[model samples]
Target: MQRYFVQESHWQENKVTITEEDAHHIKKVMRMTEGDSLIAVHPEGKAYKVSIESVGESIICVVREEITDNKELPQQVTVVQAIGKADKVEWVIQKATELGVSRIIPFQATRSVAKWDHKKQDKKVARFEKIAKEAAEQSERVKVPHVHRVLSLQEVIEETKDYDFRVFAYENEVRNGANRKLSEHIKEMTPGTEVCVIIGPEGGFSPEEADELYQSGFTSVRLGKRILRMETAPLYFLSALSYEWEE
Candidate 1:
């Protein structure tokens, strides 16, 4: 079923009113007419099987049934990803959501290549959020992983201090030619703990910045001897976390 997120206020007594964009999409683009079936997700975590009863500036409908989502992971993994160009960042957001990431933080790393001023930053953030929402729907994610506004490296490190555990993907820090697999660390993580993973930008995190993160209680973990691209690292981490956390 096609799913659209709706605010809790829009649903009342088995009736749902779709507003703004959703209303337009159903009426104009999809050309859905009366009695059409679709799924509406309420902000309070209820999924409704809805039938279109009316359409106007906004859509009004009656709920045919209610569904409860129970596929969410026990642990929430938030990835503080370094800022990258448009395409790579979109890839990270999509794949990370598919792998069950809880949240995503795009930040400025020591070696980041994407430059943004306040005006441009807001636009970028909005675009990123759209990507996240679409990805969540495609992947059947109960909750869309939030795309947090961009932050500088120091700000990100400071902001993440209160997380239960923090890990940083460091390509250059692997020991003695041994492949540092994520599975090695997954066995130690307990369920329901919030884990934060940081993936640096192209050229990777500088040694100085890595040191500061280490001091801030983030353990630098090596993904492997062969460094993965910035866009690929978070997906790798989230996948490994999913396997361990779910199994």
Candidate 2:
């Protein structure tokens, strides 16, 4: 069944209204008819098996039953990713959503090369959000991960107050032979814990930024013996998290 993250307003009682792109996808792309069933997710993260009732300007789906299977991670994992090339960031958002990230924050590291234009920030974030939503649907996720506006290192440090656990990927840990393993840290986290992980840009974080993060209660952890690319690091962490928690 196709999955859609329907807006709160689009859902009325047991009926779901899908419009625009989704409607086109159903009517044209999927060639789904009135009887076809799909999964419609509520804004609050509930999902229902809905069968199409009417198809026209807007597709109306009647609720069949609520889907009880939860695909979200037991803990909320938020990735604070430094802005890199546009395509790399998009890839992280897409794959991270599939791997069960609860939120993604784009950070501006000292060595970040791709900068976001303040005027186009909303547009850029919107595009990233769309990518997350599509990935969520593809992954059969009940909740779509959020993509926050770009934040500077200082801003991210201040926002760390909300997380229960914090860590950052530092290559120095590997080079210095620091026995920091993500699995060791995962053992300390309880269910419902909120974690924030920081990934550096292509050029990596400056020593000053890393120091600030460490001082701000962010533990330095190594993904493995080898260093990972900016985009690959988060996915590696998320995969490890899912393995430890879900598998």
Best by lDDT: 2
In angstroms, what RMSD does candidate 1 have relative to the true structure? 1.9
Q: Give per-model TM-scores.
A: 0.91, 0.98
Model 2, range 73-94, lDDT digits (tens) per residue?
Answer: 9999999999988999999999
Which is the leading candidate under TM-score?
2
Q: In order, what lDDT does every prediction score?
A: 0.81, 0.92
Q: What lDDT score goes with residue 14 in model 1?
A: 78
Over 9-65, each residue of candidate 1 has an lDDT whose tens digit, in order, gives 777887889998878988888899889998887765557789999888988889998
Colliding residue pairs in candidate 2: none
Regions of candidate 2 where Cα sits further than 4 Å from its true position: none
lDDT of 1 at 210: 84
